[model samples]
Target: MIHKLKKRRGIPAGPLRVIGSRAQRPGPAVETLEIVLKCDSFGTVEAVTTLLGKIGGREVEIKVIHSGVGDVTKNDILMALTGSRLVAGFNVGLAPRLEQWTKEHGVEVRLYNIVYTLAEDLGALARSLIQTEPEERILGRAKVIATFKSSRGSIIAGCEVLDGVLAHGRNFRVVKAMGPVFTSRIESLQVEKRPVREVRAGQQAGLKVTGFVDVRVGDYIECFDPPVGRRSSAWSPRGAVLRFDENA
Candidate 1:
């Protein structure tokens, strides 16, 4: 014989209990999170990818969506953050319109005013995340990298390559202590008064910039390169910039 319990919603509702040798409850479903990395300059691609890979490995559900050099429009913002919890690595100064739109849409976005250099921006963003209070101020270095042309149209630069490789015809910045002073292109590269195709880490080289003039010694130089597949924990010598080479 079996006991018939009174049904409430097409089922018995009385203690509503189950009996078994071992009771098992379903585990919570894992969530799939996404992130979007938008970069305009090629120099930042590798460093940004390395940083994201590290973060992704630590967080099981998080994923990174990589975007290339281009304008970040309102549509891009909406699509990227539609179901994401965080947005980062966007240059607010270059996309003022998009920045305003993000603010209006109630999306949570972290704005990095510094541009072109991925490693520097990543370090800055990581530091900001640990702060107890959020500050509206945007922090960045003032040094700029510029390439100018001599009378013979040879590219000349009086700047320091802050990070990555500076190749011919690459885009760079001429910066002062306040912020970005100018945007220009590299016309030619010269090292030790000798013309060359590329400059590597710790090498002081001169460049011919397409735009602007009066390049100074103290100015910062930025370069663009392909994304790096791996990262090293080893610290480079102080004041030394990194140059990515597949063979090396």
Candidate 2:
């Protein structure tokens, strides 16, 4: 977006109104964003593309798949849907249906009036493409020493914590012969006959996990936390609205 430049070169100014509001975008994958660029003039197109090409900082990339010196066209929108699903412009406008199409099909339209703002926004979007997905982390591991039946005859795995404490209410994966059997959570943990919240490493305990009925003497219990949330971030949309006689 480069403001303070009034030379239109040979482009005509048309009836313009703000088009397309943003829709919910999914978490970007770890890849480059190939976008489409449309501008009011050839000069602006080259300048905007050059500005975006320098972004993404090696961790991600901004690749312009299509470039044209005209209003966004239907072909541009169709081209965007191939993968990048994005269209950007300078001094352009859009039609009503194009706005709906973007919201419906998850296409992004970015129209910039300032070149600096365009570079900054696309840079941030590129960085956001670096994946920070949710992940499960191991909390503890325990080795099953014996398999026993309770007074009511429900089988329980008597175990000694190999390392890390077996925590209550945390999810656990049952493993045996170096392979996973099933996943369940600690339903009960007991040292002797009294229920406890956790048992530490080097300690003997009887544990019951739901959905882990086929307990074996040599099976292992791996406790882990569920997948965590994404990293914190916030960004506001800049001059993204476009109004023109035609839409892509």
TM-score leader? 2
lDDT of each: 0.47, 0.70
What local lDDT score does residue 92 receive in model 1, on the 0 to 100 scale?
Answer: 27
The worst-scoring run of ten residues by lDDT in candidate 2 lies at 15-24
Error of 2 at 195 (Å): 1.5
lDDT of 2 by residue, 1-248 (tens): 22223224422233222222223235643357777777888778777777776776545767777777666755566667754677877677665566766766667788776677777777777676676667888888999999877545356789999988898898888898969988877888999978999988899898875554688888898999988778545332221344222234
In model 1, the number of clashes is: 16
Full-model lDDT, candidate 2: 0.70
- Each prediction's RMSD to truth: 23.0, 10.5
lDDT of 1 by residue, 36-68 (tens): 455546555445555544431221233455344
* Model 1: lowest-lDDT 10 consecutive positions: 15-24
The TM-score, computed over Cα atoms with residue i paired to residue i, of candidate 1 is 0.30
Stretches of candidate 2 off by over 4 Å are 1-45, 57-121, 129-132, 151-153, 209-213, 228-248
RMSD (CA, Å), candidate 2 to true, equals: 10.5
